[model samples]
Target: MGVHSVNWEPFLTCAVTGAGDTLSKHPDLPVTPEQIATAAIEAAEAGAAIVHIHVREPATGKGCREVAYYREVVERIRDSGVEVLINLTTGMGGDVVVGDRGGEDTPAPGSDFVGAMERLVHVEQLRPDLCSLDCGSLNFDDDRLVYVMPPAYLRPSAARIRELGVKPEMEVFDLGHVAFASRLVAEGLVEPPALFQLCLGISYGAPSTPAAMVAMRDHLPEGAVWSAFGLGRMEMPMVAQAMLLGGNLRVGLEDNLWLRRGVLASNADLVRRAKAIVEDLGGRLASPKEAADRLGLPPA
Candidate 1:
């Protein structure tokens, strides 16, 4: 589908915070659970139907996979009485950093690889409305680090995530990843009308362009509900591209820090901008309840 088949009513998601090391780049990036929750609330108010969450170490500002941090963030969001759906990330604990190029079969010192179940500890405990299921491994924006998620790990993780009654937003960074995700859906691991998030513009992944978004959308499994986002400067452009291609929209500090060339943006700022683009294109923003129904998720 292309501009001829635009998604007239699309839901918007705000990745309130990500697991990336963006603290030094943006001083106001949400670090503590309190700050993250506040950001989520603000993003929801600005027009996000769903808020994607990733917890960080309060003191160091580095992402951590602790259940305590996840729990606190979830609890705070719940207490605020916001009507936005929560989408927690399960993309952590899959890094495999190799040291030397010659003879290093063993994982390097910075590797954080763990079993599938171990990575979902937070999702299993918090049971958010949605959680990411990174479909395949990729060179994680750096030569030395590769985010590893082979089928051996993904099959079991998909089953467990289904058992927990939470929707898994299959995250596809490349075309091959989309094929593997289709295989998982064929195996009945992902529920009917499986959800996908096309991650564009990361290193060694699909570029953030209209052609790339159209290619990924064409390759998606039949009846799959998908959204797409670009990194850095491509973030806003993909918003219009994805919406025009019959897909949903996503924008946040997690993907791009700049509202413009030199101005830093909060999650809410990005969401508001995306909302305007959607409206300008004659598209209606879906409410949280509407998005939940479309994705087959329980109410937030």
Candidate 2:
């Protein structure tokens, strides 16, 4: 035989800008609605099956809970004809921060505030095909963000997501989160062929290593549609790792800052790089429609 090639087609998602430490870190992090939409549309054109988004105020670059911001971003994306699955993050309200001594008495500023329904309100209104529902809570990084998702909270969040006809893309940060997600499926809260995002390399949670990815992948619900991401340097490596383990991949300025060392990156650039890696490994890129079908979402 002269030449034969293996075909491995995996969907790619571009997480535009995450809701963490981006304020002072990157000068070009998309903060305005126009910026977010432009970046997302460009990423779609660059071969992102999905555009995972988190909205921040243009003036402050700080994470905002205003539903209007989400509305503007979603509307812009829809009008732009990018043909990419929209995956807005519902992982916002789950943040919990405890106060200093005797501070439990005093509610920590902006900690553990919004309820489950409130968290999914934007998703309900915007009706993005998919939204991230963080499976559980964990101690976040030096940012001192305490990510908290109690069962009491997640149950309602899942129910709300179902009611709105929006898919809950369960975010599994650790092994326990995987178990919790399965329980949600068992409880009939989350629908069949559950969608999941295996978040790795974030501090104090699962390490971004092959062993960790395998463990989490094995624990996921059978036939579950899943994507994986590694933060910082391991972000792109985990894309290939997730593919080897038979899963999809996600990348963007959210998880990583550089196209290479000392060079700032863009959402489109991340997707382009991810495309090259997947293709080099003999994996084909999935289109937005294909990705939507794979994840049981309404096609773009």
Using all chains and alpha carbons, the TM-scores for the candidates as numbered come to: 0.97, 0.94
How do the residues 84-145 of candidate 2 rate in per-residue lDDT, one tens digit apiece?
A: 88989987777766667546543467665577788887888788988999988898866456
lDDT string for model 1 (1-300, tens) is 333477999999999889888999999999999999999999999989999999999999988898998999999999999899999999889988887754556488767888999999999888999999999999986678889999999999999999999899999999999999999999999997799999999989899999988888899878899999999999999999998888999999999999999999999999999999999999888999999999988776
Which candidate wins on TM-score? Answer: 1
Top of the candidates by lDDT: 1
Clashing pairs in 2: none
Show model 2 residue runs off by greater than 4 Å. Answer: 1-7, 102-106, 110-112
Clashes per candidate, residues 3 or more apart or on different chains: 0, 0
Pairs that collide in candidate 1 are none
Q: Which ten residues in a row have the lowest lDDT in candidate 2?
A: 1-10
